[model samples]
Target chain A: MPVWQRIYEEINDPGFVILCAAQDTGGEAAAGPIFDAANATFIQVVDPDHIISSAFNFVNVPSAAWVDEQGKIVRIDEGTYSKLHELGEGDTKISFGTDVYSVALKDWVAKGSDSAYVQSAKTVTGNIRQHSSDQLKADAAFRLGNLFRTHGYADKAEHYWDLARSLNPDSVNFIRQNLTLSEEGSAGETFRDLMGDYVKSGKDYYRPLDIQSPLQPKDEDR
Target chain B: MAKAMMAYPELRHPFAEKPIHAEGSTTVLYQGRSITLARTGAGAGLLIQPDDLPGINGFTLKPEGACYEDLCVPIGANLLVDQQGEQWFDLTGFADLLGQPYVADSEQRVWSFAEIPAKRDGMMLDAMAPDFKVTDREAQVVSMADLKGKKALIVTWSSW
Candidate 1:
């Protein structure tokens, strides 16, 4: 979040805006402090219903869409990262993210349609995930669960949430959001196992980034 | 064990147990909006008042059909039902006609509906942004239409 705030400041283009949404079912209590710590000046949304994710058909967090001035989606559904980040220390340290996506974003903001990073409408539409009937029902079920959760119907909430997971087993957002309620937490053994199965089954947790970094060239390009 | 990133087991059921709505009222969830209707027709399916159509899903009762934007769904026998002396719009039936999925808890009189398929046609064909309305931290409503002339990056992240 702080990283996004930094990037938003660096871009500093009045015409460019970043709407960062927290897809946390825990609502503002869980996500508000993080945004405040980042000093986010751009649009900040604390979405407990995961409305943004459902709007874009994103199965996981850290996903994004780049909408141009015409309200057309120029780039979408990518695992967006402003820069490389590391956590912990010593052998237990974990590292993730990339610095390249931020540079490409800046290019798009400055160059608009002329930016090589901007994809064609055809490609953008092609990249969008086509959800099935059951998957659509899953969204409804998830919202039903959220409604129950909000109203203190814990039993009903659990039931519908379980139903949602069964209807759309591929939704990592649902999986992790459900796990957040458990004692082991979201990144626990269950999440790791599900991610393992996801990889073993040849499913992409995120769509591969199409932009190429100028610093690292492919063998063919080199 | 991996360190827990954004766990909140304590916040799971923090709110006190209470009924979802008043005894006679019905709650409808659509596109992230929760609308509680004070009056409805009695039936196993959701039969909302014709006048409450626009607030629920932005469709209005017209002479031609239930109209929204440029698209109109011709009124069908199952869509508009006549119960006794009242005319109630069958919302669940309309959802079925539109292939819009929904989950209903009849006991609680709550129904949650997914995005209407017709509304997403532009996004599927032309890569247009879907119509979504959400509120910012300051409680100002924001919609895709609000970002018309500016380049916007709408990103989703979670604590977990």
Candidate 2:
């Protein structure tokens, strides 16, 4: 069984109320399968406008915020892990290690705040990377690209799209979306080639985007 | 009114027949009629329009007082007119500002604002998560506050 599948089963147990809050910054089509397979109730919040993510100070996906009974945030850990999976045995290594995550979660549930592992509010805030002005500009450029795409200006959109990619090279959505757009038209070769070069650099930032391409060998075996 | 005229010397609009003194961080004139005037630091002041409430910290002038959704705040005796003839509010005089019934005091846990340009960071994770409701899948009325007592793990995932 897959790690997520095992996690799903554990969640479905009657004692546990596995409420998943998805930061659907763009839309909700991708996480649908896991939610369904887990047979668990998933609450999908839309950030199609990114209003929530910006307000909550979320910068990464698979980032989990643990809220206590009083509604105050208790823990925030990045990445997901389950007892059923290995670290490098998948197309994506987005999962956090199972041993570390399970021990922490079990301690949290058993002892609540008394748990020594419970992180302080300062530590939680410290874990969040402070966003820079340059990144905000890149985000704006990407938004403009989306707006252009919506308004039927695909060619002009690529300019802002390329600017966004250059500013924030790790954005898989921008990379893959622009690459797909490039394949649709003749103008995107330079941009596509740029993304190809980033892939060659062995940066984990582009891993998710590379999953769609057949050129790269699957990282699971390696 | 003595209070209004004392606080606001420039509030000499012809249409402000019954200037109501409302106090806050600064004194403000609520004209009975519509007119525009430039205040020193707080921008311009005009007749309280119906639609302008949401933009002004989600406050609307009501018959009882400044109301927000289900709560209402009373103007009380602190509302006064000054000798020079202007209206002002003694914000400090309003003891129960937060507890004002006219003001919607519902505690909201979720923050819903856009990112400002001052903080620049590249997109770290971009994905859309699914939103489901307690009773039905199509119900969109799910609020983050509803899950207050439970530990919620919000995983943002996007298929696109």
Candidate 3:
């Protein structure tokens, strides 16, 4: 969160905005404090329904879409991260995210349409995932679960949530969010095993990023 | 991992058990908004009053059809039903016609509909950002249309 705030500040452009959404089924209680701790001035959203994800057809958290001045999507559905991050320690140490994304983001903010990172309309359209009927139904079921969860119908909530996962096994968001409410936690053995099977089944967990590595440093600094 | 990084099993089902809405009313969930319709025609599927159409999904039933912006879907027989003497709109039927997916808990009188695929054709075909309405932390309504003329990076994250 702070990293995004820092980048938002660095960009310092009145025209550039960040709408950072937390896709937490736990709602405000789960996501509010994190945003508060970051002191995020940019638009902050706590989406219990994962409405943003559904609109963009994103199957996971930390996904993003870059909309240009005319409301055209220039880039989208990447495993967006503000910076490369490492967590845990010793044998369990895990690393994810990327340093190049933020750099490319800065370049886009500065150069607009001319930025090398700005993909063409065709590319952007092609990149958007084509969700099938069952996948779409999965979203409906997930939202139904959230509605049930909100109103304290735990049994119905669990039913619809399980239905969602079964309907769209590709939805990492549903899988992780469901796991988060379980005793085993989000990254426990169950999640690990599911991810392993996911990969072995030949699914692209995160669509491979199109950005080049070893990004060239821009002349200007904020 | 920090204790903060663990899943919050405690937070799940935190709300007190209660009836979702008035016993007779129907609740519809769409685009993050939950609207309860106090009056619905007695029918096999969701038969909402024609007047309630716009509030639920922003499509007004016009002479041509249910229209939003420049796009209009022809009102077919499947979308309208007559129960007793009252004319009602079959919202679930309309959803099926639009290839819109939905989950209905008939026992609870609640229906949750996914994004209507037709509403997203602009984005899928032209790279235009699909419109979505969500309230920010400050309780301000934000939508994709509101972000026009600005370069916006809309990103999703999670504590988990």
lDDT tens readout by residue for model 3, A60-92: 989999999999998999989899999889999
Local lDDT at A51 for model 3: 87
The TM-score of candidate 2 is 0.48
What are the TM-scores, per candidate, against the unseen true structure? 0.95, 0.48, 0.95
lDDT score for residue B129 of model 3: 96
Q: Please identify model 3 stretches exceeding 4 Å from their true place.
A: A88-91, A216-222, B1-4
Q: Which stretches of candidate 2 lie over 4 Å from their true place?
A: A1-34, A45-56, A83-99, A136-222, B1-113, B116-139
lDDT of 1 by residue, A1-222 (tens): 999999999999999999999988888988999999999999999987888988889988899999999999989998898888999999999988888889889988999987778887888888898898888889999999988888889989999999998998888999998898788899889999999998899988798877666643122211
Residue-level lDDT tens digits of model 3 in B1-160: 4443447988888888889899799999888888999999877788999999999999999999999899899978767888778889999889878999898999999998888999899999999999998899999999998999999999999888
Interface RMSD of each: 1.1, 20.0, 1.3
Error of 1 at B38 (Å): 1.7
Better of 1 and 2 by DockQ: 1
Better of 1 and 2 by lDDT: 1
In model 1 chain A, where is the ten-residue run with the lowest total lDDT? Answer: A213-222
DockQ of each candidate's interface versus the true one? Answer: 0.78, 0.10, 0.78
CA displacement after TM-score superposition, residue A13 of candidate 3 (Å): 0.7
